[model samples]
Target: MTMRICALLATMMLLVGCATDDPDITVKHRVPHGSTVAVVMFQDCGIPNQADCAGSGAAAGSIFIRILSQKPGLHVASLPRPVAASAPLTDDAAVAYANKKGYRYVINGEVQDYYRTGHLALHSDRVAMSVRVLSVKDGQVLVTYTYQEDSKTHFASPDDMLEDMAKQLATSIVVEPKKQRQGDFMFYKGNGG
Candidate 1:
C-alpha cells in the first residue's frame, strides 16, 4: 500500500511539473510608437489534400484582427477580405496596400498547420502559424513570429486555442506607455530641472 501511494505521488508531481511549462515562444523587434498597422488575412498552408485546411488560414487572420482591434496604442486599419485562403499578399503588394490605405505597417502570414482530434470528447487541438510585420514606407520586414500550440492535457477546443494564439500575437505588437503623453513636455515632480 505504501509503495503504491508513493508511486501515485511521484506521478502527480511529474504531471504538475509538465503542466507548469510555458508554451508560448515569441520574438520581438522594434516598432515605433503610434504607428498604424494593418492586418492582412493569413494564407492557408496546410498539408496538401487536406480538406480541413480550406479556410483555416482566413479564420486565423480574422481572429488576429478581432483581438488586435481591442488592443490600445496602435491604430488598426481596415483590410479587404482575403482573396484566397491559400494566397497571401506579397510583401510589395502588402506595402503598397498599406501606403494607399494610410497605414505605416502591415501584418500578414500563413497558417501552416491546424488539427483537432477526438470528435465526441475533443481529445486535443493543435495550431501552428507564421506571422510577419513589414513597413509600408520601405517594404522592409521588421519582425517574424512563429507560434504553435498543442493542447492535449489542457482540454482546449480548436477555437479556444486559435483565440489564445491571436491574443498572444496581438499582445506582442501593441506596446504602449502606461502614462498618457501630453505633447513634448513630460513633467515629473521628483526630477530636477
Candidate 2:
C-alpha cells in the first residue's frame, strides 16, 4: 500500500511538471487594473509567397479586438493604421503611437504561417503567430506570446485557428487576480476582482 501511494505521488508530480507552460512566453509584469489596451493590425508573413498575408493580417487584428473586448474589466480597442506614409509599420512604431494616444498597453502580432497541408480529415492547418504586449508608458514589453499548430489537430477553418490564438493571447495579457488568503481559506479581494 505504501509503495503504491508513493508511485502514484511520483507520477502526479511528473505530470504536473509536464503541464507547466513555457517560461519564456510567460507575462513579465501584469497590466494594471482599469487601464485601456490597444491592439494594432498584425503583420502577415506571406509564407511561400504573399498570397493571403494581407487578408490574414486584417483577420488577426479584428479577432484580437473581438475576443479581448469580451473579457470583464479589459478595455480593448482597435488602433487605426497611420494615415501618414512617413509612419513606419513596425511594433515599435505601434507602441509609440499607442503611448502618444494615452493607452496603457498595446498588443502587436505577426501572422507567420497560415496554410493547409494535406486533405480533409487528414489535413493539418499550419498556423504560427507571435504577439507582443507593450507598456504604453515606458515602451517595455510585458509579454511575448508565440504559438504554432501544425499537427493533425483540426478539421476547422483558418478562422477557427485565429480565434483559438486570440483566446490564448487574452490569457497572456489579462491575468486573474490572485486569491486573498485568510488563514486556511482563500477568497477574492473584492467585487472588482
| lDDT value, residue 183 of candidate 1 | 48
Give the per-residue lDDT digits (tens) of candidate 1, residues 1-193.
6999999998886676345334344545646667778988788865888676888877887787777777776667657644666776687887787788888889878888877664455445667888888878788777777767766554565567778876776667754564543346766788566
Best by TM-score: 1
- What is the per-residue lDDT of model 2 for residues 109-143, given as tens digits with 9 covering 90 to 100? 77777775444665556667788899877788898
Residue-level error in angstroms, candidate 2, position 103: 1.0
In terms of lDDT, the poorest run of 10 residues in model 2 is: 15-24
In model 1, the runs with Cα more than 4 Å from the true position are 1-28, 118-123, 178-193
lDDT of each: 0.72, 0.71
Q: What's the residue-level lDDT of 133 in candidate 1?
A: 82
